[model samples]
Target: MTTTVRVLESSEEDVRRGPEIIIHENKYEFCRYNLKISRFINANLGFSAHVWDAGVALCRYFEKEKINFTGKKVIELGSGTGIVGILAALLGGYVTMTDKPKVLKQIETNVSINIPSVCRHRVNIRPLMWGENHTNFNPAYDFILGSDIVYSSVVYPALIETLRYLADQGATIYLSSELRKSNGSPDFHNNLLPHYFNCQVVDRIEGKDVVVYKMTKIATTSEEDPLPSKE
Candidate 1:
């Protein structure tokens, strides 16, 4: 599929046009944890992506010094706007930032925008399409990060399969998503988790707007490797 393109900056007759601005009365902050917004984190450059608010919130959850994140290998799937993966790099872990190859250029742009030069090396951006095989996949990671990815029923299985492929022996997966009705069917969490994964609710508190799930993979009886066997 051909991906849509949005220029970072546009100018006409020396007049500057910026990315469309989206304002939320209940706007949540993820660009920075403190009162100040760092230019590196929030480009103020533009808001072309989806609810980056969720990404900001997820990044805040990691940035707050509340969790012990050290020496872990992390990967963020469907990394739109690449916010969560960037935060993982900032938090002192090796993080792989993934999306389709076509979208990686801007994701790389976003990472370089926020993180220091030394830290930028720690972030690896790779191409990954759901359910399809990629040549350069590393078999293990300590965590899988995803947000708002469980919308389509067809893609849900593929997304879960992709995560299952990268999950390490004991690595945990974290996902944040809002409940939405779909085609007269149950939501992703309600309909999918029970069959493929052993899921536990990490947070479902009132007014938080999204549910965070601590997902652990369920082993299959098929005993088959999804990827080609190691040489």
Candidate 2:
């Protein structure tokens, strides 16, 4: 017996549009946001942004889990198009959406238009280069979000270091990635073992080759001894 696989063709509407509105819904409400897409063929990758499947999976996972962001401090790494961070802010988180400096403007525009005036103050757009010194960023974030950031092996060390630097001891981390091999190995997931504990796959998209990971920082030992000798 032989098996056949079907591949669906993309429509012209899907190919031609520059910016499009993406609608995501949960049990309670719906989130409607516009995404700015890059039109120039020679434009930088950051400039030509579009929603990724992993990003959509993340949004759905958050909705299903009903993760409470109310009054919590959150940061998103490699926040292209800023969709995940925007969703967190909508759920009442004080969110910082960060990416390369070149992409900040696009994130800013999305935040300005999609985030309501009341929740506007809770959202900030900034530039973040992984593995670099980020002394200006607060070290106590309650939650960190990332989507499709693990596709490149070159960024693994820097990304892991940045995560360790930003996350508080009890901080929750949510990362989504498409299940695809990169540079011949899955270094992005494999490299995270040392710095994080209780790492688990919290969610998976049924038909999409995407998974979301929920992890917490490993407990660090104190540099100084607890017991002190009397003089």
Candidate 3:
């Protein structure tokens, strides 16, 4: 689906001090989140940024699918406002939310305010630069989450490298993106085919112009062939 990229205007109230509450409703429950959004001007230009339409769509998709996150080890890359990771934690996943160092504070704040005290220990906020040496990050994560992270073409290689390095054997990956043509073609999705055995659009919210994909890593194959070689 082709979509025009339009930046939603943030009100003055949304730009003021503390975080703002955005409500995401699902068939089962409503998720109320507090996010510390960047200033309107800064956000429009993609500096740090705010909770976006695609992010909201991602949350709704999680609710609709009723994914079982209990005790799952999950990692979220480029967690702008920590919405997706926080939701995963709320659903019983042990989530690690990562972004650049500059955005870590906002992610921490969002997690602290939205996650219940009992579940707070399940969520970890950290800084991670895509493609950089991830010695500190474990490669055995059961699932990886990313929302609206395909908007930049320059980051494609880095993003793919990060995914390959972090994905465990048979790990699951969930990614959401706004279907905007201006952000470049769906090259990011195409790039994953070789690294991941199965990749497909699992859900799309047309009204919100968002698409979510479910991907799984390719299983290792034995180098030795079973067939006898012709002598």
Candidate 4:
């Protein structure tokens, strides 16, 4: 006999940081597991501490597509709230959830709470600053994921460099972003990423104003060649 799981209503769990900051949990049910994602409510804990629409959309996209994450090596960049990476782990992928050093605690907490002890070893949290020294992380990952990380043009170069270093010809990259015309996300997806990777739209979530792109490294891409400026 099999059991069916439905999307559950969200409940809150609050954690206090010092005298002022309050972190609250946003609950989600996916893959027959309940994910409790914590976020700072009144405190400005940077964007990495909060859950974004792109991340949610990507999680849904994975479930809808029935991605076979079993036994795969996965790494998620800008893993705010650790939602997407947690889902990957639940789906049987060895997942590394990464973000800025300062924001790692919340993600760690989320991972610890949601991932069962049996699946706990499959998930790891690490600090990854885009375009920085990423040598500590393995270059070969079966799948690389990012959500709402392409918001600004200023970070494009470093982000691209990091992507190039972490992804090889055999790896697949999935990036989801809310395509806001005012920001450079639209241009980055349309004009910039295509220059380096073979990119395709895997999902267009119109309701959330989000688009998920599937990208793979171009075989001829050279590390020394500069990416075209996004001016």
TM-score, per-candidate, Cα-based: 0.72, 0.76, 0.76, 0.88
Q: Model 4 TM-score?
A: 0.88
Residue 154 deviation, candidate 1, in Å? 2.2
Local accuracy by lDDT, each model: 0.60, 0.68, 0.68, 0.80
Task: Show model 3 residue runs off by greater than 4 Å.
Answer: 1-15, 18-47, 191-197, 219-231
Runs with alpha carbons beyond 4 Å of true place in candidate 2: 1-42, 46-48, 221-231
Per-residue accuracy of model 4 over 1-231 as CA lDDT, tens digit each: 111223345444556576866777777776556777778666555787777878877887877778879999999998878889999999999999998887788788788888889889999899998877676788779999999998777888888978887886378999988888877788888988887789998887654568889999876536655765544
Better of 1 and 4 by lDDT: 4
> Which consecutive 10 residues in model 4 have the weakest lDDT in total?
1-10
* Ranking of all candidate structures by their TM-score, best first: 4, 2, 3, 1
User: What tens-digit string does per-residue lDDT give for candidate 1 at 23-56?
Assistant: 2211223334212111222334233244443454
For candidate 3, the per-residue lDDT at 120 reads: 90
Better of 1 and 4 by TM-score: 4
Q: What total of clashing residue pairs does each candidate reach? A: 0, 1, 0, 0
* Candidate 1 local lDDT, residue 220: 70
Candidate 3 C-alpha lDDT tens digits along 66-100: 78799999999989777788888887899999988
- lDDT at residue 85 of model 2 (Cα atoms): 85
Candidate 2 collision pairs: 38-48
